[model samples]
Target: MTSQRAVERGASVLIDAGSLTRCRHRLYLDTAYSALLRQEPENPGVRQRREAARAQREDIRSRLSETLDGWTEIEAPDARTASELTMAACRRRVPWIWNAVLPIERTTGRRGRSEILMLDPVDGGYIPIIVVNHKVTDPGRGARTSRLTEWAPAVDETRKVRSQLRDQLRLAHLYRMLDFEGIASPNAHGGAIGYRAECILVHDLTTVFDEYDARFLDRLSVARGESFTVPSQVSECRSCPWWTDCRPQLVANRDVSLVASGMRADALREQGVSTIDELADFSGPEPDNWPFGSFTDAVAAATAWRAGVPLLRRTDEVTVHRADVEVDVDMESYQEHGAYMWGTLLTEKGGPPAQYRGFVTWDPLPTVDEGRSFAEFWAWLMGKRADAAARGKTFAAYCYSRAAEDKWLLDSARRFGDISGVPTEAEIREFIDSEQWVDIYQAVSDQFICPNGKGLKKIAPVAGFEWRDAEAGGEASMGWYREAVGYDAEPDTTQRERLLVYNEDDVRATKVLREWMSDRAEIEIPTLESLRSAV
Candidate 1:
């Protein structure tokens, strides 16, 4: 057995004089382009250390081959394949170690040979050649010039080493383009392929350039040729990294705000509105030709514009925030459990003492009940409005001083509308607006005075109204009457009467609190922004 080693030291080679005579077997080790070649080993420890290093390197090569799929592993001839793999691994490793040691200069970096290797099934057998290259096939325009400049020197060096290994191993016949996992075709731009019929082939040079040794492998090439374009679709310039430089016309005149609004601008292409100006002008509101849906949509869009929030679909959970004064107005019906005409009172402030104004629905025909039915009750409430007008008091139904209870009041109003035979959403909106109905809880939340979390009791306290405290004492117990009705065998009949009484109390309480809020400064009142500022 014979052992021969020629150390390569950057384009220079050194061989031990004793190596030529030590054994019967002739071994020729060459490092023709390295400048750090040494002539001789000082001791037996050097060979032992080298063998250990070789084993470790082989282990790394095996692990890497298993780590990523699609790459072929190769071995070198005339040396133990494992030893060659290890040597290749060492070659790649040394550069990185040098890179860390002299990070600023990056001079000592060399492509390690893990990417190309030599293999020997037996521990001390002659290594056979196995050319393995990453089977990445990128089906796009091949490497371009601008891309090539960015390649790291380490990568260039690796290529050179791999090329040298291929030449030495006589593996040129195996030079068919193998699919590389990540090597994108520079010409194809972004196209991908795992295999290429193209004759391009990369031979394994892991004994020289390990994959990890070259961090710039992916960026080693550039694509210069124009990529193939689809007939109608054109190229995906908009998504390209060089889009700004390559397709200025397509990206220059963008309306940032409109795009930021999250409206699907792509959908508006059919309307001949590719740009924001075209969209704004073409979809401008037509006063006379207003369709309710279109009008609402436009309004919603405009609202989003002003609010600086995207126009989102309407949902029960998502509330549209407005800066307008929030008035928590509740309405009450004249009847207890029965459906009929009603009166509404609104209160902005919350407290035991509340003030409010009542508006009665006009119901000419009255129903027949033992007591005043809801219709008849409305007639009486209308009389109160007349009396207030006569006395120089505001006759409006909406109150801004206390929390209003208006569940029944709204139902009654709808009944009046039905009876009046006026069927229109606009009419309903107008009627509601005329009442100036403000949701108390919403108002408080908008005002930023209350926690804005839920619950009427929580909101009422902010306006100096304590509905809980007011109803807590035995002086007035709305719950007991409600319970009594429930306990009674005939709830509809008995509950109706008690419900009316409870409704009356609620109305009165709301009214009292309203008066206190309008006149007193002791209670805290918050502006709309304050209420919603928790976020």
Candidate 2:
């Protein structure tokens, strides 16, 4: 049987799931196609499978004829003999023998290069085993291509690398039992006569029946049109390329079982049940006779299942105090001189603080908010301070050694400070040094934060707050934002909306983080002292 149009397909399905049924047929196809893709392309699995399958086919053929005197299969003894034997088998009229052989020459074209070879039963027709490595899909199956699909000709370089593998196979004298479809091109040179054949059946004797398991061999031999029942064990599917389609069907039909206990647990978890709700009966803390480790995990999984949800927990609660103040705080301003001045005194009354708050200016040029200038920002700070005083609230801000928040506020102050009578840059620097700001990052690293690097993204999540985006604009990078602002050109209204959305998201995230910090202190009270003392 000569096959001229061979095809290959790629997919991302994992071998573990019951969904592998779809991959089984593709696996067999891939095994053959992979031969066309290798550098010295020889797929031991494909060759072995095809040989074993051909053996079964020949067994059936011999049994059908009572006059058959003898039959023999010669394993590839050597290069010359293997090639000669294979060529003889293809040309024989009565005595049919299947051999895997590689063609001597290759022709290249737009579609892809094709390797021509003769196959068994070549008596009346040219059983050309034409090999092609290109992308194709089974439209009848309604299967769409994935990222694995690409423009065929665009990958000529990659194709050449793979074709070299065929060159090595030609020298190995291991080319038999391999046949493919015809080769065609989009350009000048038309295509060659294509060889067509029945589906390529692959079987691994070591797998279908193991070293000591031969009882099934008899059934496999005589069974003409029936699919012999193989072990439904998933391990059988896993190293097997056809695992995708065959394994799932086997499992659903109760033909296969996960023998590995750990694998069973994973399979169950994947099914969205981590508990005993459906698997076992439980009254309280634990279930009796739980098969896997940690009945607690199983119980959680079961609960999630009944609730129609995933078994994983996402949030942990935390708390903080209102009195962790340690430093003074104020906003800074800047002039064209590049010097800065701290102007808006927002935290002069409180203890040396651990953090600071600064107003971030949103550029709304061509539609500027006159009252929203830097000076207005300073006036707003004083207004907030006065309002807090009426309620007996002292503005105490805390800043770490790096003074990240302070630096931003300082810049803001100088840029928009009430220059009429604001403190000079030198005086502002003096007040900053007097605050004795602590460096939480250093404190934690040098025995702080309980053995973890000090990043707010990490800490905040552990404290029950996740980094979330409320809008797509929030996810835009600095480069994207700059583009919206037309960094080098006139701004558009659409860009203004994007910047507004981004600024709004920043403020919202900051507020959420502050609230999370307070909540964390309450939840982790037991560990609060350890965390602080560690630093």
Candidate 3:
């Protein structure tokens, strides 16, 4: 419910910052549905994760409360009035409000009419706070600025609002706004360092408010009339609640967007390219106007779309150093905490097909257990490398993506390693840079085009490898981890086993991709002729 309605009904309203920033059409449609129809209950797994996140936030808040003082939770007279008071107080440099609800009036011509801003206690004042449940050094500066503007008032009512705040005996100076990232870092003096927002950008807030005023009303009308158009972008479609109804229409019509990713679909439409068939059949030389940068690239993309395969650019080349033994590695991490498990699958030429091993931490609390697990896994890996060298056989670790694995390893070493047990920074650097570490994800993109997408689950099945559990995914694994760690209650062994199996399958999928690439000198480039003949 909007803050205004909530206040009128003597209830509390919770605002979701991300949802409030979405497309106007999406917001209106979702809001209308929520008001007019009962929403299907969220998936049980989704619900569990959400609950876990809430519990985590409360835990952090509790810890902070003990360290800080002079924070009070106050009920606003109404959502709109509260927002007006917030802006007035901000303009007058008033103290921060914890769980403050600022209302954006519909009459103000804004997309989201209400926002919630949290506060972190400061010496003799307060700083506006945005709490995120992940670890990241930079959480897009623009998004944070937008969020700040959302809390600010569009119209001038300084005198009236200030008078109200004075009458209500609630007025304090707000020092600044900051982002409190949820991820804990050993390097951080506290669990997080507050990132201050760029206040200069707040001036642009008025322009956005004016633009929304001009357009949002008409968009809302369209939504209420049930005439909202399905978005062409895949990311939008995938996240949309209306995907089930919209996807079939797009597929049936052979919408160009299904074949193209991102904003390129609109550019293609401007060039009179609107369908898969048209894109595939176009035989003209690369047009100088081609948005994809080259005629050849455009044709290659079209050809892949036509054949339902990933497009591999001609310049793309993939190479893997020949090794007598290979290990496919995939780490299952909970970004909310840290990497919890390392799954490795070993293979040898003319030897065993797969030897799966996992180094895991059973602790649910966010702590050094992940680092201990990583150290154990690394020692085991080094032992295997030494054995391979003694046998005069090259040994290599193959992973889908090096960034996550590399980052986790480096972070773990820095946080948990001792001088004698764990690999030093130099050794870790050499391992990552050397041919001993192979990133098959970079290899595939370098050698082949995958129109369907680059994710292992999407690409591995085409290479003839399948997960034992059909429902296994990153999200499911995270939920399993939560259950295993006893986030809600006692740890479940079944959940832990399921997590291991899922992670094992992920490494196995990488191995399948590796083997497929090894056997093919010229990567398979699906063509219309080949596709038609097979059919």
Clashes of each: 87, 63, 13
Off by over 4 Å in 3: 1-25, 35-37, 43-56, 75-94, 109-127, 136-228, 282-299, 308-319, 418-420, 520-535
Q: Which ten residues in a row have the lowest lDDT in candidate 2?
A: 188-197
Per-candidate TM-scores read 0.26, 0.28, 0.72
Ranked candidates, highest TM-score first: 3, 2, 1
Best by lDDT, which number? Answer: 3
Model 1: CA > 4 A from native: 1-372, 390-392, 399-431, 435-442, 452-454, 468-505, 512-535
Task: Write candidate 3's Cα lDDT for 259-294 as tens digits.
Answer: 674556666777787787787677765444556534
Query: Highest TM-score, which number?
Result: 3
Off by over 4 Å in 2: 1-372, 397-402, 411-423, 426-452, 467-477, 492-535
Q: Score candidate 3 by lDDT.
A: 0.57
lDDT by residue (139-253, candidate 1, tens digit) is: 2333211111111112121112112322322221111111021111221111101111112233233333332223122211100011121111122222222333323443355
Which tens-of-lDDT digit does each residue in 189-262 have in candidate 2? 11111111111111111222232123222222212112223333433443454455555664454321322223
